[model samples]
Target: SFCPDSDLIRPHRPVNPAAASRSHQELHKELQRLSQEGKTELQRALEKRKWEQRMKASRDQEEAKKSTSPLHQELLKRHQRLENVLSSHCYCCFQFLKLRQIKQRQLLSIDI
Candidate 1:
């Protein structure tokens, strides 16, 4: 049967297997790299911010020339919290990498 819109036989969408796989691989590699770099950057940023805050606190306290202050104690607690958060993020990143490694091994086995 000849239909007026016979281009329907083309199915409207063409499938390019090579292009699809290439794009998939590129995206997967990009994500993996970002995940690693993100954790590294986060660690560095967290440390940098902590040092800046500590330096500012010390300079301010010294300029004013005050004795052991309650504000100083509070700042200590805040610093501890920041360190705790960095530690937690490090743990999560480790777990994520471990899981990703397992997945990659499974994929490698399947490929073999």
Candidate 2:
């Protein structure tokens, strides 16, 4: 029977060049995979930075819009006030013309 304590045997070296070539090929494939993974991570980081910049720009535009909202309302209010004043002035002009006509008619009746 084989010895029960023989589990510590050293591994045998390959005798053919084919086995060495296979190991080299495997190592090359692993290096290429790691390089590709690193490139992908760098690409992801770049995209994330672009996304952050776009979000910041959007926030700034929203703030600018909000700041101008009150100014727009104030301009509308001023326009309405000007419209009211013009309407009142037009009405006053009409009343003045009517009074002038009536006064002229009264003078004609007295002279006749």
Candidate 3:
């Protein structure tokens, strides 16, 4: 049917077969390379996650062992004792400083 607006619709250009084939081959190769790279990246990420899980499990196991060990208990006890001693020493030093400050103030008042 001849329509008045028919000239607006342009005719399709005949595609070159050789060029089409080459374009298809290039796209296929690019797709294959991308697929391989994606698979390799996925595999590496999985391996890294697995390694992290294994490390966490091993660390938890070691911590559990240490918590139940006699040596660790002794060390914890010693640390508590040291903390107590240091706190007591700090209290004594504070008291000595207060006494020294009071004596200096009394000496200043006497001179005035």
Which candidate has the highest lDDT of all? 3
Give the whole-model CA lDDT for all candidates, comma-separated.
0.85, 0.85, 0.87
- Which stretches of model 1 miss by more than 4 angstroms? 1-67
The best-first sequence of candidates by lDDT reads 3, 2, 1
Per residue, candidate 1 scores C-alpha lDDT tens digits across 1-112 of 7687777553467777765798887977866786777665466779999999999999988976756678897998999999999999999999999999999999999999
Global CA lDDT computed for model 2: 0.85
Error of 1 at 85 (Å): 0.2
Report the lDDT tens digits of candidate 2 across residue range 52-91: 9999999999988777777798998999999999999999
Cα RMSD to the true fold for all candidates: 32.6, 15.6, 14.6
Q: In candidate 3, how many Å is residue 103 off?
A: 1.4
lDDT of 1 at 110: 100
TM-score, structure 2 vs. true: 0.40
TM-scores for the candidates: 0.40, 0.40, 0.47
Please tell me which model should have the higher TM-score, number 2 or number 3. Answer: 3
Report residue 72 deviation for candidate 1 (angstroms): 0.4
